[model samples]
Target: MSDTIQPPFSILFVDDDQMSRHHFARAVSDDYRVHLAQGADEAMVLLKELGPEIAVLVTDFRMPGRDGGHLLREVAQAYPQIVRILVTAYADKDMLLQTFNTGDLFRIIEKPLRMDSVREVLKQAVARYAERETRQQRLLAMDETLAFLAHELNTPLAAISLFARSVENDVAQEYDPQRQREIGAAATSMLNNAQYCLTLISSFWATVHKSGGQQPASGSGVREVRAARLLATLLDSYPFAGLQREWIDVDVHGDFVVHAMPNCVALVLSSLMSNALRALDGCPAPSLCIEVISEPEPEIRLRDNGPGIAPEVKARLLLDPVTTHAGQGGHGMGMIFCNRIMQSFGGGLRIESTLGEGTTVTMRFPGSRGRIRDADGEQASVTRTV
Candidate 1:
């Protein structure tokens, strides 16, 4: 690891001739860890053992069994992170053209090995190898992250489909009108759950690689969003079928706000509020309250007087891609999608509940400057997140 005596980049040299291997190894041994391969078969074995470390692969164009181009193509497909360099002495013009078509050769070293040219080409190959290695590592990480997200979303989607079919066949035919309604509602909820899962996946993917801040679609000044004003708007848009206003309170001391993508904040707040109201269904004298707490952190807490989340379901509520009370709805993608939206704006979501008491869902928004700026640079007088 010392810079003064840094080892040379590892090089894999494959040729049918023993003398050629010895000469090449002797020439490069001072700097690089040279591996001599008798043929493509031996080269493959060395490659399998020393992947990322084997920086450059020098293969003769014409070998006994498999030709150089064929080997290089295999290397490119199998281990694209390694740099491939082909050496050919008896290449016809047609074969030379074909080499380019076969694999991405770093540099073609015409054989009748000129030591100086080999040194220069090998140096270039090492540099190319470094670049390729970096790119490959990034691609591998991204692929893994995407795969994990896909797997997490699939479980909920499958459950949603199965439960939806059961509700359609069994509950729909029940004689009781109330039972039928509940069954229909359950079906609708399941479909929403699937949509919610898809939204979380799409939002997280977008936010993970987001370059800049969230910008409003219209590059306009941010509209002031007071918690009180925001709550009124939500109530007007979606009148909670049976709303309880006795404990509802909005205490905005200075003006809680956040810079965001215009309608995004509103949509997020409304969704959270709606979810809270729906969660209170069937509870005794169910009451839903919205309180804007300003100290420590600017946030809106939506509490409901309903049978709180069960212990088992509470454990995986927001963590899992799908979450819903069993038998309530076969689909449970709401909270997960809500979490994604909050994360998009440097915000967070919290859930607090007691089995027999009620559930409280808090959405926190980080404070920005006195006047929050939208993506368009316009000042937002008020900010509200439901």
Candidate 2:
């Protein structure tokens, strides 16, 4: 007992019965720091008051005002960082009928409470919370490091443009006016691209990392951006080498706001472009048309006139890594990453292709009424969570 280390975060116990709250808190207070809430409403108040200090939520199913099931669902959306547990008289039937989403509730406790079993569950729940916090810290560190590198690179890139301009001026009349203009434009484009990438990295970092005296949105990294605005930025800053830019056409008929990490969106586009370029390498004509469509749903579609994906390869593309360009350093994680980002927004991705025709990839986004909040800043309604 003396050797047992207290958890970094506290446990919250919510029950309608006064005697029950005291008994439960009294039993576990030695090993774990516990907060008592008489009902669901009180628990919510405590959550806002304590914030990040509370990690595990244990509430009785039959509570006054609001039931524990509702509390769990609300917490899962608002503060996904908190691990939730339900205390119910009838565990099996109540859990199955009430909470079909296993993702929300962590564990179900049966009454009358056995102190030993309850203690064990609390211990495991604390362990889970500790692991989640550790992972978040690691991810935040990596993201901040990348942001720092991007910020540091911006200065050197601007200096390079200035140096190039000076070198060109020193050798004036060696090139015609039109040639000089072209050289200046190219240098400016290079600097602009770096600056754009830095902006995206900074934006993503700010969204994911807690900043600007803003309360943390646990387990989410996405922010809202208009599809048209994001696409323009992506295309303009994209390092389109050689004649690749000429092969691409973008048409924005309708725009929709999508929730996602901007840099991740750019990465997804880069992956798709790389795939299309390789597929159309030896073809007589290659074209990639990107369109923002508003119809049955808000969507972004990418159509490429290249050798279409084979039936076998297409079938396995979303499920697993199916690639023909293994020799060229391709691991086939592009579509996988794209699928994850789409799903995080409560949207989906579809790939359609035919032999000798082309491939069309559609990115379906959550409409105005719906937004799925996945871990890494997907926004939703719950205001109280760690």
Candidate 3:
């Protein structure tokens, strides 16, 4: 039944024997775009022409001109993506070791291939190809994410550093003893806190990439605190602290505490803030207001006054990576990170927008409060929204 399912990828069979090529093609022809190559030269031509579309390569190890391992190595170097498989008559130890070292071969199928074994190997090849593609995309995503963080945080980081240094310089030069000491201490505190915050951001950037865009299993539980208060504290630490930022204008309409990872909550809130700010860009006196309503179900509505998202943008807001401003770069990993965090905490993200009006992003944790549970019921707690 799975074989009958639509194949989303293409594959190539590169073997000199006519029967072998026919057999491989016939086996996988029902699914996938199967191409056949009679020799290494023909395989090279096919690869160059359809490299991007092809997802896997099946080649024989003992061909007349070029052996399977050599041909596959060349293909791996040239294409890197097409999953390689070596089909040979015998499991030659030396050649097998060489193939393994080459590092792109997906599997080794013995010659006079059994139909079932060949099917299984091809199936695995498809899965491996899918995984490889996913990994590549995630890596590209991490790169984009880092660029975004650098772009968005650069200005604030510079300002914080500059202002803190200026405060110190001014304090040291002041003539009055009491005034000088007071200013010096205050400047020192501010500078220290700024440094700490910068360190945290740097650590977060490293963690995001290190995670491969996956959320860590930090689990769920509040840190002996209330939900709204926790959210407020998170907003307080954001770069726009004390600015005319809209995220600060928030009201908790529910009386509840959440037993969830505080860092996860913070990450989600940060993502919401970032989305709000992006949506509010270019608007006249942009403002964002968050309202937490928990009676029917725990939900935080993040509304903004900036121009609403386009229909297309709204449709793909959660599906695709957020578009970074030209040269204002980012790895587009923030939202995905937030989404993963939410899912890990038994929650999901929702967005509604009206172009030229405004947009709102809502986060809802579906699990019930009082007896919050994860698979094994690891003592999860829910802070009811008041």
Best of the candidates, TM-score: 3
Candidate 1: minimum summed lDDT over ten consecutive residues — where? 210-219
> How would you encode candidate 2's per-residue C-alpha lDDT over 228-347 as one tens digit per residue?
887887777555656778888889888876544445455555556556766877778989999987644577888998989999999988789777765433556557656655554456
lDDT of 1 at 303: 78
For model 3, residues 310-361, the per-residue Cα lDDT tens digits are 8875677566766543233344555555555555455656677787778888
Query: Cα RMSD (Å) per model?
Result: 12.7, 15.6, 10.9
Query: Please, what are the lDDT tens digits per residue for candidate 1 over residues 214-276?
Result: 333224664655666666665554433324343344445444644433244455565666566
List candidate 1 stretches off by more than 4 Å: 1-9, 15-32, 38-45, 48-53, 61-81, 88-95, 98-104, 111-120, 127-151, 155-195, 204-386
Off by over 4 Å in 3: 1-3, 90-104, 165-286, 290-303, 306-386
**Candidate 3 residue 242 C-alpha distance from true site, Å:** 4.6
Off by over 4 Å in 2: 1-224, 371-386
- Please give the range of 10 consecutive residues that has the lowest summed lDDT in model 3: 377-386
Please identify which of the two predictions, 1 or 2, would achieve the higher TM-score against the true structure. Answer: 2
- Count steric clashes of candidate 2: 6
Give the C-alpha lDDT of model 2.
Answer: 0.70
| Candidate structures ordered by TM-score, highest first | 3, 2, 1
